[model samples]
Target: MPTDPQAYRPATALLTLGEGFFDPVAPADFPETHLRFRNQRAAAEIGVDPLTDEEWIRHFGRFDPLPDTLPAPLALRYHGHQFRSYNPDIGDGRGFTFAQLHDASGRLMDLGTKGSGTTPYSRSGDGRLTLKGGVREILATEMLQALNVPTSRTLSLIESGEALARGDEPSPTRSAVLVRLSHSHVRIGTFQRLAYEQDESAMRRLIGYVLHNLYGEDGDDPIRLLDLVVARTATLAARYMAAGFVHGVLNSDNINVTGESFDYGPWRFAPTWDPAFTAAYFDYQGLYAFGRQPEAIHWDVMQLAVSLRLLVDTEPLIAALDRFAPLYGEAVTQAILWRLGVMPGDPDADRSLVQAVERALRDTEVPIDRFFFDAFGGRLPDAYGTGWTEVRDALAGRTARGERVHPYWSGAPCSMLIDEVEAIWARIDQDDDWSALDAKVAAIRAMGDALA
Candidate 1:
């Protein structure tokens, strides 16, 4: 429990909430989103105490008045196609952005949550998110951040007191609230809903609001707004590909209008080179597979364009859509080169090297996480020549009867930037200093930045 709740603040509170958006619905409902994992380390960086169960209830048990200057973050109305059918009555049902806060890094980020409770948008059933879902989100966010992907950061996961009935899992496991920090939570469906309702005034207002708040509009021209959204969406998509991440659901409702990645559900990185990988349990048709992510993003951009018809010229919107492939390609190339510790040059060699590594990896089928963590250092077992004979011997799978296996033993292909990744087999075969390996990765990253 935090002794002073005022010590922590959401990103929304950093600046005055802009005008006329009705405040987020009251947090009167006592729907319990459980306390599971509080990212205390990350929260500490933002000066927030991830409270315990007893503490959470004691502190944030009732709704607190958001600063009066900021517009109440009214749940933006939206409609979208789920799995391909148009569902008109969907929006933020349980969670809302209570406020925004500035972190130690000085970034003004939105502090929002899920499974907080029902809202005016809660249609027919209980508006709750599962505890397991919270766990998966934490795992996904941690891995994606490590890979340097642009993603919403999870601040804390709290287990709620009430039980939730979910068909996918056991009856009444528990509910949870995941506090997230992101640039914005506005979605494409927000525009779509207004457009569908022919609420052209609100749509225009929202676009102008987004531009002023997110992109820093220099003038009042709406075309500039379209250009910003298009460019941001393209860059975001490219980063997603470069990180080998597949956002399983790119629904209009889930696609943040600000072009930031949000709603972390059903996401996975490519363990191998297969483009067909999907992290969503129900994506049976591979709608949002790794290979299709770029196209999916473009599709989402198109949906935004359709909704933007009220505000921007159709010709410019079409032209912006055309920029998706090239922009995404360039972003992906740059990101991959950065990750591999190499500059983007000689496309032919890069292609060949990547293909070879992919083939090796497919053959080895080792865990990707362990592969990178193991060979972060430039030195490899074979690099030291005959001095590494014991390392070589151990790599050959002949060891003392009671000898323990090395941490990096998983068979896998090394990245092309690894000058001597081949030496990993022998290096791990010998006792290796993990801290030394970490320093090596840091050095490589620094070198990559210098080259950049």
Candidate 2:
């Protein structure tokens, strides 16, 4: 059944756990509330497409409580390992869970915020998001979704009319508040925090909450939860490889239990197949490089396993962790075949095809997105050379899914390269022109339609 556009089913499942898991906080008093962007498609799924621009700013920007929703925002509590070094002080420094509700598919979704205000976790830094940062996240999510990645959707971006200082970008830059729609806000770090406090009771409670609310499972089996999370995380890592995305920061806090990618920071789409390609400039050690993402994700899952030790036996957790390798291998194969738009063959043949495609991509050094765009339906030009011929042979006997009839496939694939992202922001920063951003999003969605 199609969802009733007027029926907005609000949920407060997280609030049922009480104040121990979070702190009630108010939003910042911004000087202005200008609606810079609003995702009508995402809003329609949540039954809020009827909200006017003014209403959007009023609710999202001003942090006004949505009707029958969260009475107030809750800054969630958690801890994380930064570059593998445990940090007990980190959580939602500049963000919070604004509200929770069901989507059209009846899945519980969170309406979370970024740059909303300072929280208990905001150390010495100011709680604000630069306008450029907000724009970058929008681009990241849009392009990832186009590639069929399970990612949080950018619901709205509101110019908060604040000037913020930062060392990363120019000082005193414009600021904004962003709302994202996600499946769950529960992270591996959330478990770590409870384990750190040695609160086994709270840890079990949290596990139960996740199992029931987010996963629709009844009883809380820590091993069962670990298995589910491991499988999802493995699939997520494969999707990242398939989409050519480098989520610069893969910290434990950034990884959600649902394995839906969110919280874009210093992210990049690889221009080529370079394994050493790092997204964040400060990643001097190349710890979270494009090629090393799978390892990093596996490491984060191990930390989750470590935290679950407070409630379960260690051997089962380790056994569950052991599943990562095969799961990731299988997922990457499926992901690559999906991207190529071809039916799968025998396991050996599919593996060979994936290997050949990777070799072709690396040896040719062609733009990754362009390669996928050009080679859609297993069609590669002769100019691609011997490496591509290997891929073609591997694709033999496999059926192409459908014809590439969409207009987006006619031209260059919509790519969110760093240069293009800056160009879009430059237009907005210099001439206050938003046409480029709007057009880019439309193109990305059209590409998604074609791929679908």
Candidate 3:
């Protein structure tokens, strides 16, 4: 039976864990609440598709409590490693868990806000998000979701009518508030904070809450939890590679226990298969570059294991961490095959195909997305060298997944490279034109459907 799109089921699951996990905070009062973007597809899943634009602003922009759900927004607290440097003074500085609900599939969903307001963790900075920053996040999430990456969906964007100064972008930029729909907001840093405080009881309680509410498990066994997180994180890293995405920041706090990618900032798609391709300008050392992402993610998972050490012994945790490399390798093979729209082969054959693809990508320096686009369903044009020929041979005997009937597959691949991102933002910034953004999203979704 199809679930009713109008029947919203709200949950207070996070509240059950107690107030120590979060601090209640108020949303910023924006002078103007002009709705910039609304994710109807995401809203339909959560049973909020029927909301009018005015009503949407009231809830998302003005921060009205959802019916029978959270009475106040929660500014979640945690600590994290920023660029491998431990920072205890970080948390939900500008965002909060606004509300919780279940999607059509009955999975717990969080309606979280970014740039909502200032919290105790604001740390002398204004609690706000740039309008351009919000726009970038929208593009990043949409493209990632289209690429089948496990990620947060941008639910709403509303211009807040504020001028803000930023060091990265042009000063006096526009401001906006964004709402994201995600599976879980409980991060690795959430556990790290408890361990840092040496509060074993709180750590155990949080573990129990996470396993039950987010993962649908009931036990608080640290080893079990670490194993699960490790596997999911590995899959996530593999997907990022398949999509040629540089997350720019793979800090422990940005990594949630659910392993769903969220909090997009300084994200970029690799133009070519360059290991040192970095997305963030401030990442001088290339610590979180495209090639190092797997390592960074593994390191973050290790932090989670360290945090869990407060509750369990070290040897089992080390055993769990050992699973990451093998799991990541397997996941990479699977992810690449899926992107290539081909049936799985034997492990050795599949690995050979992946390696061949990598070699072709590096040797040809072909645009990453274009290479995948050109090689769709194991079909590659003859205009390439031995590396591509190696890839073509490795793909032999594997059945393509489905017919590429969609019009999108007949054209150049839809990509979200940085220049296109800047052009999209320029349209909105200069002329308030959203036609390009809309068109790109339509194209991206069309590609997603074709790939599907």
lDDT scores for all predictions? 0.59, 0.91, 0.91
Question: Which segments of model 1 are wrong by more than 4 Å?
Answer: 1-24, 28-35, 44-73, 103-107, 345-452
Put down candidate 3 lDDT per residue, 23-127, tens digits, no spaces.
999899999999989999998888888888888999999998888689999999999999999999999999999899999888899999999989999998899
Q: Which ten residues in a row have the lowest lDDT in candidate 2?
A: 1-10
Error of 1 at 343 (Å): 3.5
- Model 3: pairs clashing at backbone N, Cα or C within 3 Å: none
What's the TM-score of every candidate structure?
A: 0.73, 0.98, 0.98
Q: What's model 2's overall lDDT?
A: 0.91
Candidate 1 lDDT score relative to the true structure: 0.59
All models, RMSD in angstroms: 10.3, 1.8, 1.8
Ranking of all predicted structures according to lDDT, beginning with the best and ending with the worst: 3, 2, 1
Question: RMSD (Cα, Å) of candidate 3?
Answer: 1.8
lDDT for position 407 in model 2: 85
After TM-score superposition, what is the CA distance of residue 18 in candidate 2 from its true location, in Å? Answer: 1.9
Model 3: lowest-lDDT 10 consecutive positions: 1-10
Which residue ranges in model 3 land beyond 4 Å of their true spot?
1-7
